[model samples]
Target chain A: MSSQAFTGGHKASHQELPPEFQDQEESIKITGFWMFIVTDVLIFASLFATYAVFVNRIASGPTPAQVFQLNTALIETLILLTSSFTIGIAIWAMRQNRQRMVTWWLVLTVLLGMAFVSIELTEFAGDVAAGWGWHTSAFLSAFFLLVAAHGTHVTMGIIWAVALLFQLRRRGLTTVTRRKLYTFSLYWHFLDIMWVFIFTVVYLGGRLI
Target chain B: MHGGDEQHETAIEPGFDFISPRFEEPKFPMHQVWGYAASLVLTFAALWMTVNRIMSPSVLLGVVLAMAVGQAALQLGVFMHVRESRGPAWHLVPLGLAFAIGIGLVGMSAWIMLFKSGVS
Candidate 1:
């Protein structure tokens, strides 16, 4: 992969690509990327199922109906949903190979992500202030686990996006960088999907119960 | 012709190699009009329902979650090119998800048994 070779400037057709990359580079990358996504899907699936099984296992703690604030939860939900939209724009920019555009869109995505997390943390603090600790009961425990896990994923996504931003600057949109971004986009969207479960099981279900 | 003895061996080399260095579909296609319109309708409906108190609080929450999942899927399929990956690497995504679930379930069950067995 020299830039010249990649751009088809010099190498002859019979140059025989490097042995390791002669026949499986794209296949390998594709496989690796899909494997990563499948594993992640399984992880989120388990969380959803677990939350379902233990949703009512209050074990002498505040129930979801008692602890959840639907109004504020709605706001948090909107923030995250909007952020996902921004990230979609970022991916579109990447596809167009608009370097500056991608960079700016990612920056916007990172900012929105930070805002979502900050709002969530504030909400958590408010819950604590009202004396609803994670250990207060089984319901709260599950609540903390489900929502916090999703939060952690969002945080990781923000960090990943930022790192990729730097990589974009240093490496530009090379094939390697493009693949990396494609993977990260998958990851970011997956995080959004996981939050859907959180909103349903923890927030809405909690209130209904 | 550089190696004149290679004429017979040309059959050994496949034209379309499995490890093809080139990739054709570099970008995922976007249906901006449809995606935007659908998203707007969904969001507006969800918002109006929430504001007007049509759905119960819990139901509202569920609807919101569903909306998010829908939007995320749209982005992944349309913008991320996950489904377009040449190999089965998408399988790893699900596998990772399964392991994460296993750990969460086992850990939570253990905690419940340890602390709340008699109570609940």
Candidate 2:
């Protein structure tokens, strides 16, 4: 069973790990992705540190109370959360071998991700238009650095997802495609968790003081 | 023995023991649905508490940060399928350590940098 290709729909385990971890090499790749996530955690940790350290250093520029739009941040958070759930469903559908359902769920996740990024970009553009650029102060710089870094990751995830859709179409639900989708869901969920911290630390915490 | 949608254990192997990863896809995504609801609640509860100034500043920060941790746990457990693996779940070792170190870095950096306000 370890060497046999799974025709999934039952349980996924050592011998039936869906298509993603259906083999040793495939699961090892999955583990490598987790290691990548660990590194990402450290990267974000340092960025969070920078943001916290510089938050109070407004240096005669716009304070978070002035620049932070609670409404926009709330919208972005909600969108990302929903997208995370959708990607979970997408993977579930993949395991169930419901190809069409998987496709629909992935499409929904991508659209939601696009909406989240759009709102974030609009917020940034609004700030810049009002002369509250990242260059204005240490606080703004840290804020942009942390957030734009997350936004850039979201952008990359979107590209990865779009490319994955093409792969799914081309390769169908082979072990390769399933592994790719599984990893993409992990990446998507990781981004949502990062956004959770951002909302708590940057947006809500900004108004705490 | 040949049912289409029966719950099953691994028969391909002779031994079943603890610490071995198990996987199941239920008829409904109970974990995911509940996790989604819980996350939304945590997100808004934190937002409402902070927006209304329901607590002192320090306590509010602590509460929201704790909620953020809760959200992370939900994503890791429910969405990421962190426990579902083919091996001994070795990935959690590095990930757990990273969380400890990462949290320390964030906390220490904040504490040390606050002294700049005192200097100025």
Top model number, TM-score = 2
Tell me the tens digit of each residue's lDDT in model 1 across A90-163: 65665565779878877887888898899899989988998888887766776787788888988998998899
Candidate 1 stretches with Cα past 4 Å from truth are: A1-27, B1-33, B43-73, B87-120
**C-alpha RMSD between model 2 and the true structure:** 5.6
Task: Please give the TM-score of chain B in predicted model 2.
Answer: 0.78
Q: Count the backbone clashes (under 3 Å) in each candidate.
A: 30, 0
lDDT, candidate 2, B69-94, per-residue tens: 99999999899988767655668878
The interface root-mean-square deviations, each candidate in sequence, come to 9.2, 5.8
Q: Isolated chain A: TM-score per model? A: 0.81, 0.93
CAPRI docking class of candidate 2: acceptable
lDDT tens digits by residue: candidate 1, B43-67: 5665566556576775676676667
Candidate closest to the true structure, highest DockQ: 2
**DockQ for the candidates, in order:** 0.20, 0.41
